[model samples]
Target chain A: MGGAAPAAGAPLVGANSSGGSLKALDGRVRILATAAFALATVSFSHFGPLLIALGGAMLVARLVELPILKTLRRIIAMDMFIAFMILMLPFTTLGEPLFFVFGFPASRQGLVEAALIGLKANAIVLMAMALLSSFEPVELARAMGRLGVPERLVHLVLFNIRYIDLLYRELHRLRTAMRARAFRANASWHACVSMGYLIGMMLIRALERSERILQAMKCRGFTGRLYLDGEERIQRLDLVFAAAFAAFVGALTLWEILSVAAL
Target chain B: MHIVDGALTLPVIAVGSAITVAGIGLGLRQMPPEKIPAAGVLSATFFCASLVHMSIGPSSVHLIVNGLCGIVLGWAAFPALFVALLLQAIFFGFGGLTVIGVNTANIAVPAVIVYYLCRRGVVRSSPQVAAIWGAVGGALAIALTTGCVALALSFSGDEFIPAAKLVFFAHIPVMAIEAVLTAAAVYLIRRVKPELLDAFSAASPDLQPVLAAAPEASLRSTQS
Candidate 1:
């Protein structure tokens, strides 16, 4: 949760960091970071003997002081239900009986499995945190394009990230206004309904705002395709970074393969 | 409520992806030129709405005003939402690539439902009636979407039912919050930007003129 504050509060870490050395290092470093991310994600999913390794990798990546973990904490806040899922996994899975309380038995295997699952989930989450913290939203959208995501899709994402804050501010103002008007009530469902209507209003405003924004963009020559300033050149450093990250992933994957083959 | 990759079955993801692509194609084909900007704003609004979280009891949930989206954008909301979710997946990784279809469907279906309901005069006719219907409809949409995602996950052989139950229950307070939020938003737009309603009404056949007389009176007063 501590990780989430920086991204949510600052909101421009990725976008504003596009200067000089940071700009130079952006592509290469992001490539390495994303490679680490992919490894971390795949490792988390398997979570057999690889839990400790994935966790270690995540901790090391976090130590790199990237903003990834912070942003991730904010995003993962939406998954509160997963907390209950984690809590139940240890008590429900089938396994050898390890301990008993009253008539219920705790399975050792279940505990171990659940612990691994937790570690894996956290590792994947941390990896995501790191990537988002380091890469600008626009850069990421561009990268997705390079990776074959559709042009219209990329445009939509860029605009969405750009204008999200405006909608939030509008909602906040409206809510404050409502409260000022003494729109208070008891715990009746009607009060709830009132709130829903307010949200609906926010959506309507958002639509109008988007229309204005689009007209603004069109006035400035925004075709369906997004055009970034400056030419994108893949440098020697980028190749080296990509190669090094690939080698690291390849080595770890080989080790995992050998370990499993040996068994 | 965005499902990550490797959480559900491959077949489920494949089917979901196909459906999402088809929906996007359909949405794109039907989008009016003037509405493109509105779609963009809705996309941004969806993105921004997910950021404002309020704690509900032991858990927290963010707002997703798909009902307003449906009412305003009609079928175009699907493509707009797809773009937003895709950004969320890549930029934030909230939802993974594999489940983009499932997540989009989960959110977009409610927007579509709200769109249709608004057309049917379930809302947009009377402020009081709209408020009540909007609240219940918003709650039902969130629940139904969550249920669909859960069912999809369960069919994929993941331990999804219990997780879904927990999610659905936790959402009870949040949904109520969302309901209030939606209703108030509608009421505000009704008061301040009444002409916007006319535009929406013109665009969407379902949203008939509820306060046609009020707008005319306001217009007459301004002219005088």
Candidate 2:
């Protein structure tokens, strides 16, 4: 959000999608925070603590200025899978006797497992939104590259992100062309074959285009390593943010360790 | 099917990431510099494949062409699929950022398996044989992927074993759809440019996939 009087959740449109000043707090720090939060929440075997962790993640997401609804949108997909698990797990888990559902037997441990999975998924997703979504892909790749990730993998990620949208558009246009040709595909084998033709055509187009792009790059003096511009150093504010997150991780880990020990 | 964030427990996540990291390392070592763009394009193709959905028996399912990728790209599918999976998570949130490791392993591991098992058959002169091999790779990829997803779920607790079995069962129709699609594509490619596909990385000459060895031997290739 811009200025002193901006409305709540109204982050300024161009105001660095990277969680603002907090987001600028170094890619390495952000990566660490994401991993630590994920590990801590995912380690929880109990349902009660998982709820607290989810609430804490939501609270942090709010504090760090991530859009809650947008974060929740990601959580929705996880919810579907979790829902499926809960529906199927209860009846099939072998454990101490629990209330019967339908004709199948439901186990207490199964119900707890379902609840933990749901809560852990939500919490981890929320933290990811708060910590990782802010940084752009290129920046994330760069951070990872610096952090000992293979250079080729980073370059692959860069190239993939750069071309992924373009290819998606190409696929859309191809599908449109098929539709224009009055092609109707359903669950039939004929439809599958038609779709296969479509994909084959798409693959040929993509390979040829790649060759062209490679030739163009070579013509313009290309090397195996793509050099990215910008040498922005981590500033003092970034250190402060990193320190805060580090302390948070320590506290969270300690709490989890104590809770598990008690259990 | 990409497993969303936090769906897996710590042990599964650690093992998955370790395997993925190793596989990508091998893939990079195997891939030559000139072939980078090819891998990138194929990665983008898989990325776009999500946009095109087809109806299978009772429901529609998006294509996860790790099998095809593995057949063509070999171990390189690790990095390619990893990049695709990451972008999917970041842009579409179809999967989660945190769980990219496990999802990548789940998809890419099966692909590499298919590559080793079926890449040879795919590059053959016989269209029917190639199609049969493609069908096997396609069916196998989804089956193994479903198993990986189920295993990841089961890691949360023993209570998930039945649910895991159900996940595998639910994908039986998807396996059929993948088989049909892959077989058709294999047939078409056999008719088209054979050089465009490679069963292994360009670096290796030992098993030089059928494409590299085809022209000199077969005068009659993919006619009609």
Candidate 3:
């Protein structure tokens, strides 16, 4: 488990450095900023404001020293998933024809709509990655609890964080055993059944592990309550971040309002 | 199969958030304090399970296994799956923050539905028969989830209807894969640890004995 590397899609916080101002902010502030940014970005429907939101997200990404090439690659992969919708839009949507693809007319309106969605999706994703991904899962859960999230939900989140890495290592070990058995995945029923049994084994093991964990907690006099780490007061850095973020969002909102009024 | 932010309309996002909050509330109410450790660890297992990629032809797809989650965790699946999605959004950026609510509703609602529909057969029937019900529940959950995704998409706009339809059709293979996996998992649980299923059905105090065994008398004996 200690040797397990981060999954491909799951990027770690500040992989190149241990300390940064962005990582020092309170988890609560980061969560609220990401929420506000996403909401504001999604509310845009036009190209002008949407592109600006994307640019703003890029600025934040740079400020946080995000890996530029990696972030672009991730966003492009996301676009591929939605490419079908974007491609179909020009054909299905009725409006002024931009050009003819084969025998079909591609509408300008559909093109604009696709671009709008692409921009909004990219901006929101970048903003979230920039802000919330910096904090550890436990820290985020603690903040969520402080933010009035239900205690049970917070506990569930913490439990997930504690065990995800352990189980992931278990999965790796099981797969290694499978590899040693000369088993390979292919498009066959035998393979499916093998994988199924593998997962079945995983579930059984996880249940037994949980049983032991519950026993251990009971031994320690755990009484349905967990005392989280020390009280997280709003530090000076947090207040500064909040002010800067508010100003950025305020600028975006002003731009959006101006664009709408002009239209 | 998460729908990223900016794709959904305001109304869809708002309605999805409301429903998800209510669902989590119901799930939390059903879960007692004693179940928290079990629920947490099981949900963590599910989160890890989802990271496993299965090969199909030349492409690979990760497992969504919400059906198996529903059968095991029942109503608790809502909060469990929601936490998983929230983590994915935060750590992986696979789905955006705003759409987490919608994604949770789309995934977890079907899980709860399958729980209600198949939990009885899963708990009472023979292992072989139970596997069949598990397969049905797995397929039904995915089918319903895709349907929900489609509805959410189309409700957002007429333009999204095509994309929504495609989403459902694209997941047809996933349904079959999940069905096979769920059947086998259910069969194993029934054989290896049938008591796990009994937790939801009976008020059996399985933890009470463990707690009783933890007092200083046994602790001191073990230390010696």
Q: Which candidate is the best by TM-score?
A: 3
User: If you score just chain A, what TM-score does every candidate get?
Assistant: 0.76, 0.84, 0.88
lDDT of 2 by residue, A117-174 (tens): 6677677777766666676767877887877776667778777766765766666677
- Candidate 1 TM-score, C-alpha based: 0.75
lDDT per residue for candidate 3 within A59-171, as digits (tens), equals 77777777777667767877776788778888878899999999899999988888887788888888887776655667888889888888778989888888886778777
Per-residue lDDT of model 1, residues B1-224, tens digit only: 77665455667767777877876765654333334466666667666666655554454556676666665556667788887776555445465554678888878877777766664454356766755665556666677777777777677644446666776776666666766666666666655664544443344322323322243343334335
Give candidate 3 regions above 4 Å deviation.
Answer: A1-19, A228-230, B200-224
Poorest 10 consecutive residues of model 2 chain B by lDDT? B215-224
lDDT of 1: 0.58
Tens digits of per-residue lDDT for model 2 on B158-200?
7667778877998887788888888888788777856667523
User: Which interface RMSD values do the candidates have, in the order shown?
Assistant: 6.0, 6.9, 4.1
lDDT tens digits by residue: candidate 3, B1-224? 78888788999999999989988876776555666778888888888878877778787777898998888877778899999988876666677678888999998999988887988898899999999999999899999999999999899889888888988998898899889888888898898888776544232223344533343444344435
**What is chain B's TM-score across the candidates, in the order shown?**
0.81, 0.86, 0.88
Ranking by DockQ: 3, 2, 1
Model 2 in CAPRI terms: which quality?
acceptable
True contacts kept of each: 0.39, 0.53, 0.66
Deviation from native of the Cα of residue B135 in model 1, angstroms: 4.0
